[model samples]
Target chain A: MLREDVTEAIRAAVFEELAAVGFARMSIEGIARRAGVGKTAVYRRWKSKLSLVLDLLTAFAVEGLPAPATGSLYGDVRALLEVAAHALRHPVASQVIPDLLVEAARHPEITEAVRATLLDSQRGVVAQVVRDAVERGELARGADADRALDLVVGPLYWRLVVVRDARLPEGYLDDLAHASVAALRA
Target chain B: MLREDVTEAIRAAVFEELAAVGFARMSIEGIARRAGVGKTAVYRRWKSKLSLVLDLLTAFAVEGLPAPATGSLYGDVRALLEVAAHALRHPVASQVIPDLLVEAARHPEITEAVRATLLDSQRGVVAQVVRDAVERGELARGADADRALDLVVGPLYWRLVVVRDARLPEGYLDDLAHASVAALRA
Candidate 1:
């Protein structure tokens, strides 16, 4: 296999290992075997298991976060929700996230990576969306943007990921978008 | 030690083991060792590690959930949020919950226990509060009680547990309660 193909295969194997047996039990040798690569190949790419996992998580975090400019704050909020919902619903992400969160609590280095790469990037995207909304006068001045951002994205995470309720009802997103707007205004 | 004392010791040890190594690595022998009890003593109280964990989780779930009748819907909502916030903020709970949630996704038996003992009971409490609000004319007729419940409790979980943001701003509960009511109205 080419270098890029080998890299992709390793990534896929890592996710599978994460799903099958969470982060605590996942091993570098096991990941190598699953990827059909030698231990040397895995070690060449990543100095340690932590580095590999962090790089994968960082890559996932930075992918496809578009700051939606949908004319109205309401539309922008809905657009953002759509992106979040899709990501949370991804099969690997749905499983990996909860496990990683627990891992983050235990490992400070992982926690730092999550905060810097994932959480900071997400916060930046939402902040930009809120900033645009405020400039357009759709949102009132001095609204707590941070808290409003939490309200906007919190429900989907709660219902879909935390509660493990995968089957979202039809129009749930629309209703959630509307509620998020209402919460922001409130 | 008396039988009750042994059981209590075993329970405490299980929590410590869960915190130290997480659920995937937690074992009955480890728990017994930590509790200063024999393995047979641990087994006598509970058939298996899963059963012991589930029982402890069920006990925690049923401990202190009261649907506060605070006359006003707003007050009731805040009360419920307070209860949820307190539980989520508990030291052991803050750690164990995320671990158990991941475990639940992999294990059907844990999933069922969580649904029946924890999620359903919490939902029932929130539903009762929403029902009272609607009957008192504080909430509109035909409001989506289920979605409203999600809104009411989602932010606290997102902020405290998921994001691990333990320091909520002053009057955060009031703001959340107000936003929830707005979401319900919307």
Candidate 2:
């Protein structure tokens, strides 16, 4: 395989392995077999199963939810939620996220990796959005960005991922966006 | 072992095993070994790993979050977040809830089991709490209970479980409870 193809193939295999067997049972051999590459190829690129999974996860996260400067806090928050909702709706993500979340609890190294990559990266985007709101004077200064982040992002995650496939009312994201804005302003 | 002792032992084992290895790697034999009983002992009590986990999860769910009738919507919502914050802080739960959530995505039977037990039971309580709020005129009538449920509980789960040891400023739950009520009212 070309170098770029090998890289893409390995990334695809890791996501599938996570979906099929979850993090605890997911193995380098399984990933290699699924990718149709030798285990050596897998290791030649990434040093271990943890590093490989984390590398792919970091790359996926670095795809980065767009930070919209829609001029209003409500507009920015809604756009971000729409992007997040679409991403969480992916087939592999719904399986892989909670699985890795479980792994993070068990391994300190995994915990730090996820915190630095997924958690920090997402929080940074939201904080910037919140900063935009503050600058607009739509939100009071000194609003807790962390709590605001939790409020905006959490419900969609709960409804979509943790509550997996629960029937949603029409315009669920719209309602959530409104609710999140109210929460932030309050 | 005495009959009740056996049952109790099995229950404890399931929680620990879930915390240690997660749902994917957890097995009946491992549970039995950890519980210091034969596989027959586990089998006699529950038909499979799925049932055992579900049964225990139901019992844990049935322990039920307090739906505080604190006379107003704000008071009640805050009370629930406090209870939920306390519950999610349990080390086993921080691990096990996400594990089962992942399992639910892959297996319809497990999905149904969790939905009926965890999702339904919790939503039922939150629905009743919202009903009280509407009647009290704290929140407007015609609020969406499903969205309300997500607003109240999601942030706590996100902060404590998924964020997993993110540092909090003082009175984090207080800020969260306040934000949740604002969102629900909006």
Candidate 3:
């Protein structure tokens, strides 16, 4: 395999391993075997599984989160929710996220990396969206814009990840978006 | 040892094992060893680790949830958030909830038990609170009560469980409760 192909193979295998056995049981040898490469190839790119998973998850999250410039608070929140809903519904994500969350609780390294990269980046995006709304006078200057992000993102996480009952009503995002904006305005 | 003492020891050991190793690595033998009891004592009470965890989790959840009856939407929602916040902050619950959620994704049996016992019961409590508010004319009869429960509970779960960064401000719950009530009113 070419150098890029080898890297890609390792990346794909990392997620496959995570989906198959979870983070605690996952090993470098297992990832290498699934990738059809030597363990040296995996080690050369990343020093450890924590770093490997960290890098890939950061990349996946950044790639998946496309900030919406929908020009309205409701539009932006709804669009973000739609994108989030789609990503959470993916088979790999459905399995891998909760597993990683469980692992992150025990490992402070993973916790900091996830916080700095994934959580902070998403918060930044939400801040930007809220700023735009405030500037447009759609939201008040003293409103809880940061708190609104939690309100918008929280329900999606609650239903998809924790509850898993999937009682997502039709047009759920639409209703959620409407409520979120109304709440922020108040 | 007396039968009650053995049962209590086993119950305590389950949380300890979960805190130490997590659900994926937890075992009946390990729990028995931790509890200082024979395997038979553990097996006699529960058929499998899943059933054992399920029964304990159901009891824990039921005991933790008190169903606030403050007779007002804001009062009830805030009370619920307070109880939930206190429960989520417990060390054992902080460790065990995500582990079970992760395992639940893989095991349909766990999913059903968690949903039936934990999620449904909480939702039921929220429904009762909303029904009281609607009857008292604090909320409209046709308002979205179910969605309000998601808004109320979601942020608490998101911050305490998923984010775990502890950005929870001094008056976070107060602000959230106010916003939740406002959103439902809107």
Residue-wise lDDT of candidate 3 within A1-186, one digit each (tens)? Answer: 999999999999998998888888899999999999999999999999999998987786565355698988889988888877886677555777667767876787777665655466678778888888888998878655458768878878777877774658888888888877766776
How good is model 1 by TM-score?
Answer: 0.95
Q: Tens digits of per-residue lDDT for model 2 on A1-186? A: 998898899999998988887888889999999999999999899998899887876776666656788888888888988877886787545777777778877777777666765567778889999888888889888866677778998898888888875466788888889999988887
After superposing the true interface residues, what Cα RMSD does each candidate give?
Answer: 1.1, 1.2, 1.4
Retained native contacts per candidate, as fractions? Answer: 0.72, 0.80, 0.60
Off by over 4 Å in 1: none
Q: Give DockQ: model 2.
A: 0.78
Off by over 4 Å in 2: none
Question: For model 1, which pairs clash?
Answer: none
Q: What 10-residue stretch in candidate 3 chain A is worst by lDDT?
A: A58-67
Order the numbered candidates by lDDT, best leading. Answer: 1, 2, 3
lDDT of each: 0.83, 0.81, 0.80
Can you write out model 3's per-residue Cα lDDT over B86-141, one digit (the tens) per residue?
87787655678777777776786777776765576778788888888889998888
Candidate that scores best on DockQ: 2
Q: What CAPRI-style quality would you assign to candidate 1?
A: medium
**DockQ of model 1 vs. true complex:** 0.77
Best by lDDT: 1
> How well does candidate 2 score on lDDT at residue B184?
89
Which has the better lDDT: candidate 1, or candidate 2?
1
lDDT of 2 at B126: 88
Better of 1 and 3 by DockQ: 1
**Better candidate by lDDT, 2 or 3:** 2
